[model samples]
Target: MHAGRRFTLTEILVWTRREILVLFGLSLVPTVLYAGLGWHWLGMPWVPIALVGTATAFVVGFKNNATYSRLWEARQVWGSIVNTSRSWAVFVRDWVGSAPPTGPGFLDARQQLIYRHVAWLTALRFQLRESRAWEHMHEPANVEYARNYRIAERETILAEELAPYLTPAEAAYVLGKKNRATHLLALQSQQLKELLDHDHLNNLLHLQLVPLLVNLYEQLGRCERLKNFPYPRQFATLNLLFVRLFAGLVPFGLLPEFEKLGAHFVWLTIPFSMLVAWIFLAMEKAGETAENPFEGGPNDVPITALSRNIEIDLRELLDELTIPAALQAENNILL
Candidate 1:
């Protein structure tokens, strides 16, 4: 996500420059038709245009609010994942031990639980990154912007990421599954049961661990819900239609008002109309970008960085010397 205090004007202009150029070109069409061609009938009354613009504004506002809610909810889901993961680390470290004296396998058991949890995070993030039919990552602007930063899931194979945390056999098994994250959770449950069978965890400890696993699954389901579903296409399509209709009619309405100043001042309508059109387009684009928080956009949740942070935190809890450093934002974005 954007980690800076605010988006710079330069960044905003750069991101929307292409759209602005298109709007400018479109605005000039009717302005030239009205002025140079003496097509007085081409001018539209300001009242009808104002009504359309007002309606479009309200629709766009609603869409943006809904999209922001989805984005915020996705962030909260990942936040819960972070908290639950840290709790898992703490519980495994403190609660799993021999009854009287430490055994050779005691530390290994703790390490296994922690490592497996890491593998789960890796699988879930990769799963979230998998492209859905409605996602905008393949859109030309999004694809172009993606070049500015790296995305871990896109850069590497999921099996490769999971390899460090899982044994070869386990990784292979997970890779063979259709829903690797779900399968990984099942593996975690099985491991917990095995620990109980081996008397490494008592009934109370096992009960505590089970609830955490359930919370993880619930959080996973929440993430999947957001990833699988999209903002209603009907609302999105109608909002776009209204915005475009209003933008197209803007120059027609403005030309008459500006022409009242004088024939020479008629050209002023082009820039002003284009500015209004660009604003609507920018707002629509903002909502569109935020609709899918897991799509690896600059505005999306920083799941890759979050996963890495969880990895580092859990590994540090194990006091490992080779723990990787946390991810840092590049160009005011983290992914």
Candidate 2:
């Protein structure tokens, strides 16, 4: 996500430059027709335009609010995953005994459970990154802007990311599964069962650990819900149509008002109309980008960084010396 306190002017301009240009062109066309060609008939009535603007404002506001809710929910799901991950680390470290019969296998079992969880996190993030037709990541503007920062899923292969967290056989097994994250969690459950059978984990400890796995499953399901289902297309489509309609007609309405001011003042219609249209267009763009929080946009939840933080914390719990450092944001954006 954008770690900076606010977006830079250059970033805002770059994001909205295409919309601004279109708005300017739309505004200029009507001003030129009305002033230069004396096509006074080109001006639209102010009352109808005002009504349309008011309606567009309401629709855009609803769309933005819905989109924000989706973004915030996605962030909360990941937050739960972070909290559960730490809990899993502590439980495996403290509850599972490192004693007799359990022997060396006990330590290996604990490490395996944590590492498999890391693999699950890796697989889930990669799955979330997979492109959906509704997502904006494939759009030219988003793709171009993405070049400014690293996208972990795009920069590395899924197998490579999971490799460090799983053995070759386990990684291959997960890769072969349709839902790798779910499969990894199942494997974790199986491992916990084995630990219980071997007396490495008691009945009460197994009960505690199983619920955490269930919580992870629920969290994964929550993430899947957001990823699979999009903001209602009917609402999104109508919102765009309304914004376009209002923006297109704004210049027509302004031309007549500016014409009454004076001859030279007629030129002011272009900038004023462009400004109004740009606001609506920018709002539409913001909602569109926010609708899909896992698309690796700068505004998206920093899932990769969050997963790394979990990994570092879990690995350090094992007192491993080679723990990777926490992820650092580049260009004031964490991905």
Clash count per candidate: 0, 0
Q: List the residue pairs that clash in candidate 2.
A: none
lDDT, candidate 1, 102-205, per-residue tens = 12322477887788899999999998899988888898777878887888888898878887777777888889998898988898788778778878888899
Off by over 4 Å in 2: 99-107
| Model 2 C-alpha lDDT per residue in residues 90-181, reported as the tens digit of each score | 99989877633212332476787788888899999999999999998888788888887999898889998887778777888889998999
Q: Which residue runs of candidate 1 sit more than 4 Å off their true CA positions? A: 98-107
| lDDT (C-alpha, whole model) for all candidates | 0.89, 0.90
Query: Least accurate stretch of 10 residues (summed lDDT) in model 2?
Result: 98-107
TM-score of each predicted structure versus truth: 0.96, 0.96
Give RMSD (Å) of candidate 1 vs. truth: 2.5
Task: Evaluate candidate 2 by giving its C-alpha RMSD to the native, one decimal.
Answer: 2.0
Give the C-alpha lDDT of model 2: 0.90
